[model samples]
Target: MEAEIITIGDELLIGQTVDTNSAYLGQKLGSIGISVSRKTAIRDNESAILQAIAESQSRCNILIITGGLGPTKDDITKKTLCKYFNCGMRRDLTVIDHLEKIFAERGRQLLETNLVQADLPETCITLQNNVGTAPGMWFDQNNKILISLPGVPVEVYHLIEESILPKLQETLQLPIVEHRTLVTLQKAESLLSKDLEEFENTLPKSLSLAYLPNFNMVKLRLSQKANVASDLIIDEYFDKLIATIHDDVFCLGDKDPATHLSEHLIREGITFTTAESCTGGFIANRLMQTPGISSVFPGSIVCYSNDVKISELGVDPNIIETYGAVSEPCALAMANGVREKFNTQLSIATTGIAGPDGGTKEKPVGLVYIAVSTESQSICKKFRLFGNREQIIQRSSNAAIWMAKQVLTIPL
Candidate 1:
C-alpha cells in the first residue's frame, strides 16, 4: 500500500518549525508495507487543506495528516476534515472526561477551548492520546483510510504506538518488508563503491542496494519485499555482501554513530572522555546524546586556545611552541592528558584549524589532528579536509569519534 503525508502549518513553510512528523509517519507506514509516495507541507488554511485532502485521497489507499489539531484558534484541522467528509461535529464524552481528569490532576482551571478538544468529526473513530490532550482521528472515507494525528512529535509517537499501528496491523493485509543497513567509515563513497563493485554485481535482482552518505560514513541499505523474494535468498545475499566487504565495515545496522559507539563501549565496559579544540564540544555533545553514557563517559575539556590547553588539559607548552596547537603532538597530548585526568580507559581528542582565516603556508585551512588514546597506547592521524567553518568542525568531530571507535574496538 502507498500513502501520502500532509503536514499543515505556517511555521513549517517559514522554517520556524521542521516537519518531522512526515518522516516518522513515513517510516512507520513503510514498515507495515505501506510506502509513502509523496509528502506535502502547507499553511493552516481551510481551502488549502481541503484541496490537499481532495488531491491526495484519490491517489493512495492511506493518507496521514499531522498538525493544526489543537485547542487554539489557529487549529482548524478538525473542522476541515468535517467539511471534506461532509459531516458535522460531535463532542466525545470520553475525551471530555479525560480532559477534566487531566486538568484536575494538574491543579489547573479548564477553559472552554480545552473542552472543545473533545469535539471531533461525526463519522470518524477517535484515537486516544495518552501523552497529550489532543485526540487523533481515523477516517475510513470512500475506500481510503485517512488518519489525522496531533502535531506534537511526542503525541504523534504515542498515538501511533499505542493505538494506530496495532489497528492498522489488524485491519490491513500487509506484506513483509525488510531493510538491512550497515555503516562503513573513513573510505570515500567512490572508493568504497569501486571496492564493492563485485559484491554489488552479485546481489540478487530482488534485493536493491542503496548508498546513503553522511558526514564521514556511508550507510549501505538492502531492501526487499517478501512477496517478491524469499527471505532465505535475501539472507544469503546479505551474508555474502557483508562477508565480502567486512574489512571496511564498522558497525552493521542503521543506528547512528553515537548509538553504535555507545553499544560497543557498554559491551567493552570501557570508560571514555574527550578533549576538544576546534570542534568546541561537538563530539562531546554527540556522545552525551546517548542515554546511560555517563557510566562510560566522564567529561570533555574544550580548549580552543593554547592557554586553555595549558591550563585545563595539561598540554605541554613546548609541544605547542615546537609543532603548533593543531599538530599530532598536541592532539596526542590532549588525549593523554584527558585520559589521565579522568582516569578513563579510553579518550579521544581533536585539534584543528577550522578557519575562514588564520592559516599559514605550513598549515592551511582544514588541517586537523585526531588522537584516540587507550590505557596502554595512543594513535594519532592528521587530516586535510575541505568545507566552511561549520562543516570543518562537523567533519573533524565525526573523524574524532570514528578514531575513538577504531581504537577502542580492537580485537581482543
Candidate 2:
C-alpha cells in the first residue's frame, strides 16, 4: 500500500520546528510494506489542511495528518475534520476521563479549553493517546484510511506503535517486508560499494540494497519483500556481505558507533575513560548518550590545552615541547595518563588541529592523532584528514571511537 503524510504546523514552515514526524512515519510505514509517496508540510490553516487532505486522498490509500491538535483555539484540526466528513463534534467521555486523570495526577487544573480536547469528530474512531491529551482520529472512507495524530513526537510515536500499526495490519493485507542493516566505519561509501559490486549482482530480484553514509560511517541496508524463501535469501546474502567486508563492519544492525562501543564495553565488563583534545570530548559525550554507560564509563577529561593535558591528564610536558600537542606521542600519553588517573581498563585519546586556520608546512590542519590504551597494550595512529572544522572534528571523534573498539574487540 502507498501512503502520503500531511504535517500541519506554522512552526515547521518558519524553521522554528523541524518536520521530523514525516520522516518517522515514512520509515515506520515502509517497514510494514507501505510506501510513502509524498510528504507535505503546510501551515495550520483550515483551507490548506482541507486542500492537502483532498489532494492526498486521490493519490494513496493511507493519509497521515499530524499537528494542530491541541487545547488552544488555534488548534482547529478536529473542527476541520468534522467539516470535511460533514459530521458534528461529540465529546468522548472516555477521552475526557483520561484527560482528567492525567491532569489530576500532575496536580494541574483542568481548564475548559483543556476539556474541549476530548471533543472529536463524530465520524472517526478515537485512537487513545497514552502520553498526551489530544487523542488520534482514524477515519475510513472510500476504501482509504485517514489517521490524524497530534504533532507531539512522543505521542505520535506511541499511537503509531500501540494503535495505528496493529489496526492497519488487522484492516489490510500487507506483504512481508524485512530489513537487515550493517553499519561500517572508516570506509567511504564509494569504496564500500565497489567492494560489494559482485555481491550486489548476485542478489535476487526481490531484494535491494541501499547505502546510507554519514561522516565516516556507512550503513548498508538490505530490504526484501517476498515469501518464505526471502528470509533464507537475506540471511545467506547478509552473511556473504559481512564476510566480503568483515574488517570494516562495526555492527550488524542500524546502531551508531557510540552505542555499539558502549554495549560491547558493558557486556565485557570493561571500564573505560577518555582524554580529548581537538575533538573536544565529542567521543565521550556520544558514549554517555547510551543508557547504562555509567557502569562501564567512569568519566572523560577534556584536556584542550597543553597545561590542562599536563596537569589534569598528566601528559608529560616534555613530550608536548618536543613533538607538539598534536603528535602521536602526546595522544598516547594522554590515553595512558587518563587510564591511570581514572583507573579504567580501557582509554581513548584524541589530539588534532581541526580548523580552517592554524596550518603550517610541517603540521597542517586536519592532522589528527588517535590513541587507544589498555592494560596490556597501547596503539596510536596519525591521520591527515580533510574537511571543514566541524567535519574534521566529527571525523576525528569517529576515528577515535573506532580505534578504541578495534583495540577492545579482536575478532577471532
Candidate 3:
C-alpha cells in the first residue's frame, strides 16, 4: 500500500524542531510492505493542514499525520479535521473518564481545557492513547484512510504498534517486499558502480538496486518483489552478488559503520582507544554512541595542537619536524602511543589537514593519514579527501574506523 506522511508544526517549518516522526513512520510502514511515496511538513495554520491532507488523500491510500495535538490553544488539528470531514465534535465520555483517572493518579488538577482532548470528530474512530492525554483519530473517507497521531514520539509509536499496524494488516492485502543492504569501504561510489556494472545488469527483472554513498563507504541496497515463496532465490542472488564484491564488502546488514565495528570488537573482546587530530573526537563519539560500548571503547585522546600531540599522545618533536603531523609516520606514532598508554587491545589514530585553507605546495588540503595498531602490527594509510572542513573530518574519521576494523582482523 502507498502512504504519505504529514508532519504539522510551526516549529518544523521554522527549523526549531526536526521532523523525525516521518522517518520513523516511513521505516515502520515499509517493514509492513507499505511504501511511503512522500513526506510533507506544514506550519500550524489550518489552511496549510487542509492543503496537505487534501494532497495526500488524492494520491495515497494511507495518510499518517503527526503534530498540533496538545492541550494548548495553538493545537488546531482537531478543529481542522472536523471541518475537512464535514463532521461536528462530540465529547467521548470513555476518553474523558480515562483522562480524569490519569490526572487523578498523577496528582494533577484537570482543567476544562484538558477536557477538550476528549472531543473529536464525530465521523472518526477515536483510538485511546494509554500513555498520553491526546487521543489518536482514524478516519476512512472514499477508500482513503487518514490516521492522526500525537506529536509525542513515544505515544505515537505505542499507538502505531498497538492499534494502527494491526488494523492495517487486516484491511489491506500487501505484496512482499524484500530488501538487503551491503556495506563496503575503501572505494568511491563511482568506481564501485563501474566495477559492478555487469553484475548489476545481469540481475532479474523483479530486482532493483540503489547506491547510498556516505563518508568513506557505499551502501548497496538490493530490493525485490516476491512473486511467491522465493526466499531461496533472493538468498542465492544475494550470495552471488556478495561474492562478486567480496573484496570490498565490510558489513552485510543494514547497520551503520559504528555498530558493525562495535559488534566486531565486542565479539573479539577487544578494547579500543583513539588519538585524533583533524577528526577531533568524532571517531570516539561515534563509537561510544552505541549502547554497551563502554566495554569495548576504553578512552580517546584529542591532540589538536603539535604541543598537545607531544604532551598527550607522546608524538616526537623530531618526527613532526621531519614527516609533518599529517604524515603516515605521525599517524602510526599516535596510534602506537595511544594503544600503549591506554593498554588497550587496539587503537585508531587520525591526523589530517581538514580545511578551507592551510594548503601548501608540498601538502595540499584534505591530506590525511589514518593508522590502526593491534598486538600483531601497526598499519597506516594516506588519503587525499576532497571537501570542506566538515567533510574532510568525517572522511578521515571513517577511514580511521575502517582501518581499525581491518587491523583487528574482523571478518567483513
**Model 1 TM-score, all chains together:** 0.94
Give the alpha carbon lDDT tens digit for every residue of 193-278 in model 3. 99889988988887878898988789998887764665425677788779988988888988878778887777778898999999
- Candidate 1 Cα outliers beyond 4 Å, as residue runs: 228-232, 410-412
Query: Can you list the residue pairs that collide in candidate 3?
Result: none
Q: Residue 127 of model 3: what lDDT?
A: 88
lDDT of each: 0.87, 0.90, 0.88
Q: Which ten residues in a row have the lowest lDDT in candidate 1?
A: 403-412
TM agreement with the true structure for every prediction: 0.94, 0.95, 0.92
Put the candidates in TM-score order, highest first. 2, 1, 3
lDDT of 2 by residue, 26-105 (tens): 88998988999999999989999999999999888899999999988888888999989999999999999999999999
- RMSD to the native, candidate 1? 2.1
Residue 240 C-alpha lDDT in model 1: 74
- In terms of lDDT, the poorest run of 10 residues in model 2 is 226-235
Of 2 and 3, the candidate ranking higher by TM-score = 2
Descending-lDDT candidate ranking: 2, 3, 1
